[model samples]
Target: MDTIAVDPDLYAAQSAYAPDDWQSETTSIRSSIYRGLMDNGRRIPSDEQQFETYEAGHLVDLILDSDRDNPLFRSPIGADRERPLQVLDIGTGKGTWAIDVADMFPNATVRGVDLFPPPVTWMPPNCVIEVDDVLQDWTWRERFDLIHMRNMIGSFDNAEWDRVYEQCFEKMAPGGWIEQLEVGPFITSDDNSLPEDSALASWGPILQKCGDRAGRPCDIVLTMPQSIKNAGFVDVHEKVYKWPIGPWPRDQKFKEAGMVNSQHWMSGMEGWCMWLLTKYGDPEPWTKDEVHVFCAKLRNELKNPHYHAYHKA
Candidate 1:
C-alpha cells in the first residue's frame, strides 16, 4: 500500500499541542503502532485512517446515491421543494460527511460538531466545523432541519446516548429529520467459514467487554432506533447495510465496497484495539506487545478469503 499523502495544511490546522505532547499523553497506553493525535486528545492511526474515513464516506454516498427514491435521506424536508435547510452532523470526523453534504446541497447550511477541529482548510461556504463534545449540553440557538449522526457507535454510554437523542429532539425543528448511521461491532459469517478461534471472531467480544467496563457499551446500534423514537421522533425508520469485511462478495458494487471496507478495518485495527484492550481487557489486561500480536493475527484473518465475514451498519 502506498503511504497516504496528507496535506500539510491539514496538519497545520491542528490545535496548538505539539507532537511531543501528544506522544507523552499516549505513552502509558501506546503500542508500537504510531497513532496520530486529534486536538481532543484521542489517538488515531496515521494518515491511512484519514484516508479510510474519506473512503468510507464515499461508500456511504454510493449506497445513498443508488437509492434514487430517497437519495440524501428519508426526511421530508428536502424532498418536496427548495428551501433553506439546516443540518448538524454529530461526531463529524474530518468533516468529510458535512463537506460532501454541503457540496451536494449548496443552498443548505451544514454545520459539523466534533471534539477535534476539522483538518481540512477549505470547505463550501455553507459548511462550517465547530469544536464541541456531543456528550455535553447543547447550546445552539438555531433549530436544525436535519440532524445526522454516523459512525459514533462506541463514543457514548447508555445515559449519554439518551441525552444525545433528547438533544437532537430539542434542537430540531418541528417535522425535522434525524438520521444516524452506525455499524455494529459484531462480525458475522454467512457461510460459517470463520473459525471459532479466529482473531476476527474474538474482536467483537473483546471490544464489548472493554466497552462495558469503560461504561460505554458498543451495542448501541441495536437500540438506537427505539431511542430516537422515544426522544419524540415520529415516523422513525431504519435500513441496514451489510458491509463485507473483505472482497469475497460476487456482486460488483458489494465487491468494491468490501475492498474499501476491508482496507479501512485492516489499517485501523491497531489504533482502535490497542488502547481499549490495554485499559479494559478482562481476565488479564493486554500489554502493548500482546495487542500488537493480536492485531497482526486479526489482520491476517481479515485477508483470508475463506473467512467471508461481514459487519452490519
Candidate 2:
C-alpha cells in the first residue's frame, strides 16, 4: 500500500497560534481529538487543522443557516405535533451539525453516520454517532423521518448519491424531507478578480480528473439540485452562498473568517499539491521549499485588507 508523509515544510509554515491551540500533539483521523478533519490527500496550510465548532463556530453557523428547512435535528419541513422525529445526518464531519441539531430539538433522536467514531467532545444527550458508510448496500427499514447530507462532494459519485437518495426516500416516513448541500468546485468569477489561471481555477479541473481516475465523478455540486429533483423529492429548492477565502470582503465578520481561512489554506497547500502530484507525476518539478515560500506569501496577503477570495457552494 502506498502511504504519504506529512511534509515538514508545509507543517512549519502554519500560522502561529496560542500555546494552548498549538500543543505538540499527534493524532490520527480515527481519534476523537481530530474532529472536523478533512483529508482530500493534500498538504495545505489548514490540512491538519481540525475544524471543530469550537475552533470555527461562525463558519459552522453560516453553513447550517442555509439548511434551515430540514435542519439536522428539527423537522421544520413537515413537523407534526405529538411525534418525536428521527433524523439522520450523513457524512457528519466533526459532529458539530449533529450536536447543534440535538441541542436544538430536544425531542428528536439524531443519528450521525460517518466512517470514524465520534469525538469525545461531540457528546450530546440525544445524538449517536455510528460507524458506517452511507454508500454501503445497507437498509434502515424505512425508519428516519428526515435525512440530511452535507459536504459529500469529493467523497461520493452520482450513482452513489442516487442510491443514497433512493434509500433515504424509502426510509423517510410519508411527507418526510431529504436535504443535500454541496460546494461547487469548478467556480469562476464573472469578474476578473479571480484570475482564470489561478490555483482556485486549476484546483477544480485537477480534482475532477483525480476523481475520474479514481472511478468516481467529483463534479456533483453543479448537479445536486437536479439530482434531488430526480430522486423523487418535492419542493426542491437551491441557494448559493459566497464564502470568502481571504479577508477581502467588506463585512467585518466575513473578513475575519476569510483571513483565518486564508491562513489555513496557506498552511495546507504543499500537502495538497504533493498528494495531487503523487496521484498524477513528479513533485520534484515543484520543490517543497518553493511551496513553503508561496504559502507564506499567501498567508501574509490574507492579512491585507484588500486581499479577497470567495468560497462558492
TM-score for each prediction?
0.80, 0.69
* Weakest 10 consecutive residues of candidate 1 by summed lDDT: 28-37
lDDT of 1 by residue, 8-35 (tens): 3423423211212323322322211112
What is the per-residue lDDT of model 2 for residues 21-56, given as tens digits with 9 covering 90 to 100? 312211211221123233321112233344432234
Q: In model 2, which regions exceed 4 Å deviation? A: 1-75, 78-82, 187-191, 263-277, 281-307
Candidate 1 runs further than 4 Å off: 1-51, 57-72
Best by TM-score: 1
Alpha-carbon deviation at 174 in model 1, angstroms:
1.0
lDDT of all predictions, in order shown?
A: 0.69, 0.55
Error of 1 at 152 (Å): 0.8
Residue 19 of model 2 has an lDDT of 14
